[model samples]
Target: MSLRWRLNLLIAGLNLGFLLVLAWLLVNNHRESIREEIEAAHRVTVQMLGTAAQTSSVFGPPDTVMVAFLQSVGRVRANEIRLIGTDGRLLFGSPPSEYKAGRTAPAWFAELMRPTLDATVIALPGARVEVVPDPSRAILDAWDRMVLIVLVGIGFVALLHTALLYALRHLLQPTEADARRLVATTRELAQNREVTRLIHAGVEDERKRLARELHDELGQSVTAIRLVAATIERGGALPVSQGAARIDAIAASMYDSVHRIVRELRPAALEQQDLRAALLDMAREWQLHHPAIEFEMHLEGDLADLGEEPTLAVFRSVQEALTNVAKHAAARQVALAVVRGDAGLDVAISDDGRAGAASLGGSGRGLGGMRERIMALGGRLEAGELPDGGFRVAIHVPMPEGAP
Candidate 1:
């Protein structure tokens, strides 16, 4: 269940349970109170009747007058009054039983309170008197008050529930907004990454094209100048030959410098082959230059779906990472692996190079640029030091959907 549903259910269930328990206690308590009131009222009324009869009999007259007075007492009470003679045969009034008009409360309510009614018998002036407290009147009043109180309580609880639900919805509104904002931000980042990737790829193409042009145009001119100088030196006088030799030496040096510049500008492997082949060749070239380092090259899955720009981005990122490792890491072994997946490509370059703390991007502009380049291509770059004293760089570039 969602948090909203769970919390609402929990709070609602607890409230309902507590209210039910409270109502149960209240009803029972009200029943007991009404019974007590009836009992107290009966005691007071019976005492008054006894007082009236005793005071009248002592102060008034003889037996004949006493009989008349007893009859008067029975008439005044109007319910039941008994005057038993000495023989227990002739009496001033009927037995003490009263008839009620109708039910004061519902029959069920009366029944519920009947079990707890108290029966009290008392000695009277001239006879035995008994009073059984009937709580019908009080029960009716108590039920009315209780019903009103319960109704008000129920209404209050309903209102409170409604308010709480509203408040809960209001509280979650900001969370909903935050979720929407996060989605938009993520979309913007992806777009920015794609733009950066394309830009970096274009830059690579320019670099390769410039290198090829310089190598073809400037290299041929220098070589031709050297040939001309060599031809003049073989045919001229001793002084002329010495001057020709100087020109030839200058031309040869220029040619060698230009060749080195071209190689530095663009690797032949990348310009001439597929990304995987280019990376393997580059790895071999690095290993050849630093024979002390053990370089492992592992490739998995297909790279045919990746366009030229994405290909260039990945290759350059790997190339820069390797260069940084060779220049700064001071490590003996390097592990480089590329795995293509349905979503994207993953490249990991790890080396046992960190002397103390592991850090990302190394300590130069080169590492920073590599990170930017990768990110611009809608990829991520992460680097850290391993626990066993090594640094690892990881790159992930998201591929387009449904690419083979």
Candidate 2:
């Protein structure tokens, strides 16, 4: 059966059993009290009749007055009135009856009392009286009433209990539904943000690759074609020809412009081979461009062991920092430090240039990009102006296990 039915039945059964026992006890006690009262009344009537007999003997047998008083008492105070002779013969009473000593009661009276029967006997002057009735019948009637009341009370309690459980379930349903909806919405938003970030990073990386290829490969081809044209116009070193000389000068200027453009587009040495060697080459190239600027670098780490993403991020951040220094900072000295920690790698770039934190962002979104990259790898980035009038950028990245 369902829980509700089971609960109701259980409570009803318990209450029924308890009430049945209590009702039986109460009914038994009440019946016993009625029986005792009846017996006491019978005894009082017998005593009064015995007293009247004694008074009649003192006066040598009662006259009309004593007979009238005895008849009145028998009618009002006794449930059974009997007069019997010493030989067991009926004397006078309604339904005159007699019983000899050691005789069985009639079958009809025995059958009338199926369960409990009581009998009380009293003696009169040369007569006897007997009272008989079943007391358990009254107890059974009281027991029936108690059983009805118990069933009604148990039914009411069951209804109330069912209503309480239903209300509690209803209250929980809405809260559970709201919690599930909130979790789903939060998950969707997080996925959307992650996808957006990945797309932006991929787009920027592809654009940089294309710009490098355009400047390095195609620009060189154009420069070579211009030089060839100049050679053709010179006609094998024409003597005293200003036109040929001017064309050669123009071709030379164009070559220089092509070289500058290629370098701006891509650091070719960076893609050539080992990143450490590439960084060294970049430092040499920068020194060539700005002879007045001093460069100091300390690289002590297993640079070959860094993951592809981390390696590229470090290279790009360093390149951007140097570019900022060249474009804005007028200081003469620059320092770069790279190290491999226990779990990852660290880099610090400092410049002793006139332009400090205030001038670090002359061109690129240098620090912002660096921050995003470092955060992606569970790392940290810091940038500030140095005390000696320049800028500093520091980065720490937690690397993969077995990484240098």
Q: Output the number of the lDDT-best candidate.
A: 1
Colliding pairs, model 1: 193-378, 197-376, 197-377
lDDT of each: 0.70, 0.64
Candidate 1 per-residue lDDT over residues 103-215, each given as its tens digit = 36677766875536455444444454444565655666677777787888788877888788889988876686798999999998996776566557657866786777776
After superposing candidate 1, which stretches have Cα over 4 Å from the reference?
A: 52-115, 122-129, 175-180, 189-404
TM-score for each candidate, following the candidate numbering: 0.41, 0.44
Please provide, for model 2 over 20-131, each residue's C-alpha lDDT reduced to its tens digit, 9 standing for 90 to 100. 7765675456556556755666566656666665566465434333444545654423245555555787554433223222343344422432334354554545555444
Clashing pairs in 2: 331-353, 331-354
Error of 1 at 89 (Å): 12
Segments in model 2 whose C-alpha atoms lie over 4 Å from true places: 1-273, 341-343, 354-364
Q: How close is candidate 1 to the true structure, as a TM-score?
A: 0.41
